[model samples]
Target: MGSYDAFCKLYSKGLLFTKPIPLKDGSHSMRNIIDQLKDSLSRALTIFYPLTGHLVTKKGDDAPSYHVILDCTDAPGAQFAHAVVDAQVADIIAPDDVPPIVESFFPFVGTVNNDGHTLPLLAVQVTELVDGIFVGCSINHVVADGNSFWHFFNTWSEISRTTFRNNSNSEFVPRPPIVKRWFLNGQGPIINLPFTHHDEFIERYLPSPQRERFFHFSPESVACLKEKANAECNTSKISSFQALAAVVWRSITRARQLADEQITHCWLPVDNRLRLDPPLTADYFGNCIQALNATTTAGELLSNNLGWSASLLHQAVAGHTDASIRAWLEAWVRTPFVYQYGQFVDHQSVMFGSSPRFDMYGNDFGWGRPLASRSGNGNKFDGKVTLYPGREGGGSIDLEVCLPHQPMKALELDPEFMIAASPSQAF
Candidate 1:
């Protein structure tokens, strides 16, 4: 593992995918769906077999200080559950105000592996609704990040579609993914043995009235924001993602209403694969990401226009080069283990991550495209914001913002913020 991978927080993430009705006639039976899913998953296991394994600790000379390794030799198969719910596909997609999106959407209850049950790193829950099925996945973060997770999901879907057509395993072989974690100069990745992670910084501090909201920005709205941001910066160019981030940062900053001298920061995850000197392929299949933070005080952030914030984001993003990225790794080795992205954050900070280029709309296991895609976000705290593409099929974007109660309500009331995001119908 690289220096950063060793201290990767041991947590689980859940993904919810709903498959609507009108399957190829015979494919809707609960038994048939489960059978097909299990068989295809079994085939997929041969490729992503490492995920089936559990993490075992290699004790050091110290007490709780140990190296955690992925041992897949005798791994139990990935967990799968077949549940039938009485809710309709429409309700599942665009429910009226009901429950927390993550709480009600994902099938998994907890985000930890050793929280009582000896859980597999990967588990799949096939929830059958009155109209279709919801594929809820619980995956350990140690083994995969967003890129690797989606790769596995898409591969499984491909295998299932092939099996559904031919009913034979004779013609399907997925390309092997690189599993070797990179280490620098033959040096070890783990520095602080069994890093001690205390309670998250946010849980103890963030004020009451916490909530998660899903907001949709259509392609037209996104374009308008980009145009406005570019105009404000006196620069003719700004990306859709940058523009959206600027708007969000401004809205959240205004809502929080921090003192003039108080500072706020925004962190964006930069995919290190492409930033490396010798770039990794799209399928490098690991946590090849780093966060780029933009710092500004409330007076600076809210006082200036959206374009100023966007320009700062653009500079941070453009500042990453191949040599700089390598140096980033070197610097971390000298600093400390566990690059806690949340370390500098407080109630006033906002950490933003967006996978705008990911093919979130393409995973079709025969029942057609997903109306929406969501991360159960078990590890996220208030002031965390994640972006996904809007389901409307254009250049739209989906923003899922988590914040304290008052600030969230303030965002809803903000005219500029409300103008961009419509109520998400099915996310």
Candidate 2:
């Protein structure tokens, strides 16, 4: 978990999954659905018991610094809440952009991940919408990354679905999580943080005023982007994700209207599970990801074709081998560094998170598949982009883009950018 200490100051990752209730007479009642979810969550916690635990701060024996550890013994269970919202599903999905009320759907709106010490590491809100249901989950990043977050979610839904089918908990978990946290051989199970006081270490980061918008790209559009990118580069080395990211990076840089020579960065999180030596399992339940940065001058990025920008991103990702990952871990263990909120405020930079590869639309809680997915007001900053698998599946993608109001308007009007993005609708 030392690899995840840097996330302590960051906000919890919040996601909202919304779907309509079936009108069938025998369909599960809202009360019944909530009860089933609550029961399944409890059973899931038995396997993922650490989530019910809190972070314990301990002082180093040799130094005056502090380190954090997960304490699960006799801890209280995860937090669960039932909520009622006076809105319909259409009110959420009919908008040109995500409704502001969506933020209220999630628990722990502004809480940082470090608050897991006092707050629940996992808090879920089952909001009852008029004729619909919204399940919002906020998980501490210090405990899990996006992969692990979804793993727990997927398992919980599986348990709920199975229980609903059998009308009993038969101890069925499709993929039990690997709770053993990963660490370097010589580093430690005890990781040291730089701060002494909890208050000094935690930050309740509030981003600057920004407008959030969802852009949908159909499979055809994404394929066209890949084709054009490959044709321009005269190689098939650039992948679909790389090509799409390049388009977003170039377009956002153009919209920001940065000076040609100004430096711009595209930071992408690379999952190191497969990139490490001997490789960690896909189900390893913690942060095994690192942020890889691709940088270029704004002038160069704009002057080049989409393929060129994508090639830069491709190289960054390809170069993140096991050796590089280990080197980063070694350096971090020597002198730990935590990410602060303000570090992501650069106007000329874009940070891509929440992979479209995640099984976002597949989480079915026995009733139905999610009609749409959304994020909450956590870890959002200017140029923050979260990618979700399109509801239509296949190769489609939904980009939840956050930007300052002015640049967002400019981006919306940018002809080249909008050409590839499908007609905007609520995701």
Candidate 3:
């Protein structure tokens, strides 16, 4: 787990998935769905057993350091809660901004990942709405990244759908996770941290208050961004994701109204699954990601066109080869640093996580596809952006943008940004 040691102080990643229910079935339908999900989750954990475990620290023999490890000997199960909300589906999906009530759907809002030692690494809350259902999942960041998180979710839904359709009493998993943790050649399964106590390490960690809004980009809009960027650059090297990220970076920087000379950064979490020497399997069940930074002065970024910013992002991502990834790992092993909240307080920056390429709309547990998707109130900060595949599918993308109240209001009014974004009600 050396690769994920830095994420220990961060908050658990939380996601909320909602779908409408038929009105005729009433309470019985809700009860049946909850029961089925619980049973299927129980079976899923047998394969993803580490999620049900707790993190423990041990003293290193040679150095005055602590090593964190998952302890599943007691088989402490994951938390599952069922709650009933008075509101209907329209109350949540109708708002232009993500409603405050959406955060309540999740199990852990402000809990940090280090709390996994005492709390369940994974906690799920099934909030029953008047005319819909919201399934909220909070998974410890140290245990899994977005890929692994969705892998477990997809498998759980598959199990539930299979059982519902077949009405059989057999355990089956469509895709099993690769639980073997990967490490550098000289690295160990025992990852040592410089901190002696968890409290002292994370005592200063505090999340800033922010407002989150969803922006939907249709397939045509995405294509336009890519086309315009490529035409400006006089090359077709800029990918759609790069072009989209470029627009977001420029728009937010403009909304923040930073000084022309100010240094701004855009950090992206690059997946290392396929970028390693011997590439790990796609289903490798852990955090195998590195934060890659692209930087420029505010003046340069704002003065340039979208293609310029897109090219910068493309270069940063393309340069993260296998050798560079290993070098980063080796450097971390020498001096382990646990990333805390507000790590970028000194800079005007943006951080991107949760890719749109994941199978966001495919988690159908015998019901129809999801009507919408949302995130919990954990790990949120100004300038944090999470991308999801649009519910409409195709090449469409949805961005969940978080920022301070004033900047968020300004961003909503920015014409350049609004031209590419669909109205919030479209989802």
- Model 1: residues with Cα > 4 Å off, grouped in runs: 1-26, 62-65, 95-98, 101-108, 113-118, 168-175, 189-209, 339-345, 423-427
lDDT of 1 by residue, 127-174 (tens): 676665677776666577777777888788888877776666753555
Best by TM-score: 2
Error of 1 at 296 (Å): 0.6
How would you encode candidate 2's per-residue C-alpha lDDT over 240-293 as one tens digit per residue? 999999999999999999999899999998889988888988989987788888
lDDT of 3 by residue, 14-91 (tens): 334454443574523777888888999998899999898998889866665788888989868899999988998778
- Which regions of candidate 3 are displaced past 4 Å? 1-28, 61-63, 345-347, 425-427
TM-score of predicted structure 2 = 0.95
Ranking by TM-score: 2, 3, 1
Model 1, residue 238: distance off in Å is 2.5
Pairs with steric clashes in candidate 2:
260-299
Question: What is candidate 1's TM-score against the reference?
Answer: 0.86
Tell me the lDDT of model 2 at 32.
Answer: 79
| C-alpha root-mean-square deviation, each candidate | 3.7, 2.1, 2.3
Q: What is the clash count of model 1?
A: 1
The TM-scores of all predictions, comma-separated, are 0.86, 0.95, 0.94
